[model samples]
Target: MSERVIGGHVAGLITVGAADALWAGLTVGSAVPSASAVFTGSPTLARGGYVLLGRRVVAAVKASGGAWSVPEMEVRRAAAELGAVGMDCRDLVRIGPFGSAPAPHPVHDEGTLLRWRERIARELQKPGGPERAPRDGGHRLSHLAGVDWRQILVERPRMGMAGSWWLPRTVVRLLDTAEHTETQWLHTARTRRIDNAVIEPPPHDGQAQAADAWRTTSQNLPTAPLRPYSGELQGLVYSVVSRKPGISRKVARWACAVCGTAPAAVLDHCHEHGYVRAPVCQSCNTQERPDHLYSNDIRVAGHYTRLFDTDAAVWLRHWHRCPGCRARATLPLPHLAAWTAHVACRTQRPTHREARSSRGRKPCGALRVSWTGGHHAPHTCVLTVVVDFCPSGEHRVLAHVPYREAAEQFRTWLAETVPAVAAVAGPDRIDDLPTHFRPVIADTSSEGQALF
Candidate 1:
């Protein structure tokens, strides 16, 4: 009852009988048994009635507890052979490749074959069972292909035509033949490259003028001299052009001012010392504050630009501060535009380092704190500028400063100081602060400056 493989010994008799019957059908010349006997492979023969004859074989397998995993199409075909008139019922039978030999030993009588036929019919009526279907057009070549041979035998078991038929030397010959066919197929595909079929070429563009220019140059150029020249010409210029500069202007300028960024209308000086700042694109400036606290590098500023583009920034205004830092982040056009233009105009000269003229160098001025405060952790103020007494000593704070200690503090002050300049402004507006201002050092406001 359980769908497990019973021992060969347990189902050995049933396995053998099904196989023998299937073989008899394939080997036309072999002296075959009655149809019921062919299907059930009952050794004992009986006359009189079909019922009594077929019952013995069924009782043998059922008593042995052999099970069938496959359906009953071939078994029914065997049944149909027995059901036909006379015993010349070979027309009702189909032949397939049973491995090797024909049925071994004594054939069953007519009556047993008839009864086995009726029992196989009864087995076919079961619902939700492996329903048999015609395979490979019911041709003799089907068995040579070994198509569904296991299903015909072990799966149905009643067919008695499984292993014994296919394992034959003759069937092995057929298998070798099939393998040869497959080899030929693979060889054709590899040698011929049939998969890569030729395709038509695309149409050429009429507006392509480069070819005409090349033709004209070929006509104008003199032919190679008759003799080879040994002398070299002086001042020969070899040219190479690149749309993308080898070194990014922003990176060059920021790292060392000698290698400057692109040019722009207005320049953002290092307000603390009035050092001429590197040209930064308007795009870089608008996305970030001059603070340099959250993100200082131009590359980082570019990344934020992509993260909050014009439309995205307009949408981002609904959520003012960065959820991560809670700083007063805004997207203004004037700063962005100025930064874009600045980077575009500036260019770095590789030889500018060698051609230095230190004519009008000025002394480093007194410390001047320019910017301070806005949600900077551990300490407040988004940015601050101080002057150092020694080149590397702890810097002294400057007098006037703009500080933003918190989100509310910065936004409130920005409304008054910078106002909302523009959603998108031009190159001139990067460091263009409002006219009205005060020095934090001069005023004794609410709380004294937070200096460490």
Candidate 2:
């Protein structure tokens, strides 16, 4: 067979064997050779001067157990004489249902697809072309190329500027020679260095700015002053300091009276001004005055009830009288004096003088003495005894316990004494203290004292 070319270049190669020649000749195109005509010269040339005859023959042979078509008969035929049953002459010569048009091929595997993609990318590497994305539509290849070019530029050459504040030589060169006046777009489009370019100054310092902020705050508040601000308030303060007319002065006297307690560990003045506006010890201005005996009794009971884990009602009920009893016992002019004297006696009892007296036989002739009836009897006589040392006819004697039992019995005696008033007053007595015993002093001036 001679060399065949179409459109000025070799299109396909040809060979002659029984099956190949048959297949080639049976092609329907007008340019094709007939099967019988080609096979007619085959047997004669089998051993003749055929240089490279083996290769040509091998190419001409069909593969084993394969099938082909015979166009002359228009039917499928077996490759009987060929070394193999069929040969894919698809590359060499086109012969199929749609003659010169090739059959569709199978889809490429991943590796082949990737290889084709890389080839496409390399071919597209030159500037102007339609841009193509990766398998998943990522511009990965373009990004990689950009990054590689950036790395090369960064590592390869250093461009310097002329003046102190001049742009870098690379930037100046790129700007001077750029195709468009929009140099920023050109820089972003062409070079990867745009990402690293400096655009603006550094951010402001928030902390330092905050530190320089203007601020305002109030100070030196004048708390409670010695005198109130307005005239009305001043008058009010004066009024409170001074007692009103026709009021009893017992409260005033009691308020001003300095408690005779020692160490001065009690309030002696009222705190009417300053941050702490309450009664305080005059010395320290911090402690409260020791309260009245009656007030202190209530306070102590209350304190014990609150702080000592005792039932307050039970504790209070033990010592406190109903109002009527308290009034009846402690009120009335005579009762007042008696109560005062009783308290005085209790206060002075520790220092009271005791007078000795004889027990058994009184004086007769000489003093008759008896020592457990060993007979010198002391004489007995009726004599007037001086009692609580009242002048003349008002003498009264009272019995007292021996010193050994006094302190121990005092609590019982006190308990007994307290209930006596309540029992005497009975249940239906009036609540307020009797008017006569309620001390009344002249309220002539407000120079001192208040708080009955």
Candidate 3:
């Protein structure tokens, strides 16, 4: 093997085996070869060397059956490799497929698909590349490089910028600098620091500069005017402030500005004006949200859904809880108050619905919970309970549990409250009842076809 260089006097790229040998030698009281001498004999720190090194390291770590953290010397060596690698390797991801989609290669196991792809995509598709994506309150995750970087960050520098940040610095720095200056390229790349080159990577949706994110560009930024920013956390303040616009995560962490509770759980903003008002807790978030105003208006509903985009598991705060029946509701988005009224309506005993039986006296309560869904999907069954003679008149969904057991519990609760609703008796009643309660589903042959 001979010396290799990428214009820098230092050699680039190192094998995981070499790294292991170096670390093992350092741990014990043995002497290893010079770092430059070792790396120079290996492959050039171009795209091939970079990719192979990462793959070998990940494989070696996996083979060792320990955690995915590379050693300190290895991390430092990797940084030196990035510094020495030529700027021409533009498509290492294209070559390595490190962050490719739809079941492609995985570098960190967890981050390769979504997190790495997102960060790498953010870098690759900047000014000279494709259009930048609009931010939807998603913050940039720092130190997404290796393991959970936060877990072992203390030993980082005797090491390097944890291999997570240092290694990807290859992608972030090398890829962009091929087209731009080293300093200019560092402006927006995802890594927090590269050797002495420290920078603040802005949140995905933030307009703040990478150099100084908290320093507002204009005298009059569209920042929330309610309060000033304050926090012990340094790097994330820009993002937290951007999400709520008015307050930092620290302010939101301990007190709801509206109610002044112990702490706030939600980042609340105004839908109409698009101004971030304050951070609020669950109860306050529900009370302040004018969901009723959005119930009927299609435009407003669309805006609200887009703005909030509540995941079903997050349990969007709602004001529809009952006393004895416990009308706690959890539903997916497209959440109109009218659509979710059944969550509240299901708790109250529905007025006895007149019915006709095959033989004699009619059984009451026409199984008011109407739904059409997959054969065995527990949560897929969106139950809409239409209570009889209830003043609301319109139908609404009370709740849809992710687990069958939860749905069954809900049905049991309904059964204990309104016996006739759960036990279908009349022939006409069978059509409107949920599949779990109905004696027979008219169509059971189809696997996924809707059974209404």
lDDT of 3 by residue, 298-356 (tens): 11222233223332112222111111011222112223222333343435433433345
Which of candidates 1 and 3 reaches a greater lDDT? 3
* Local accuracy of candidate 1 as per-residue lDDT tens digits, 1-452: 22222332221222434433443444333222232233232222112111111111111112212232111232333334333313222111111211222222223322212211122223333342224432323311112222122233212132233311112222222222232322232233233334443111123332122223222222222222112111111111111111235422222222111112222112222222122233222222222332121122111122233323433333233222211111223222212221222221112101112224545432232222232332222144333334434233445432222232223332443344333422222223323332332112221111111100
The whole-model C-alpha lDDT of candidate 2 against the native structure comes to 0.21
Best by TM-score: 3
The global Cα lDDT (0 to 1) of model 3 is 0.29
Q: Estimate each model's TM-score.
A: 0.17, 0.13, 0.21
The residue ranges of model 3 lying beyond 4 angstroms of the native Cα positions read: 1-14, 17-70, 73-268, 277-339, 348-452
Query: Where is model 1 more than 4 Å wrong at Cα?
Result: 1-384, 388-396, 399-409, 417-452
Clashes of 1: 39
Give model 2's clash tally: 20
lDDT of 2 by residue, 1-452 (tens): 21121121111212233324443433323111122322223222212111011101111111122211112111112112212212221212100011122222333211011111222234234354224333243323322100111111111111251111111222212211111112222223223224534221123333222111101000111111121111121112223433445322212111111211111111121112101111211211111111122211111111221211223222122212224223222221111212222332233322222235444432111101111110011132111111332323343422222222232242234345444433443333443422222232211121112221
Off by over 4 Å in 2: 1-218, 227-343, 346-451
When sorted by lDDT, best at the front, the candidate numbers are 3, 1, 2
Q: How displaced is residue 365 in candidate 3, in Å? A: 18
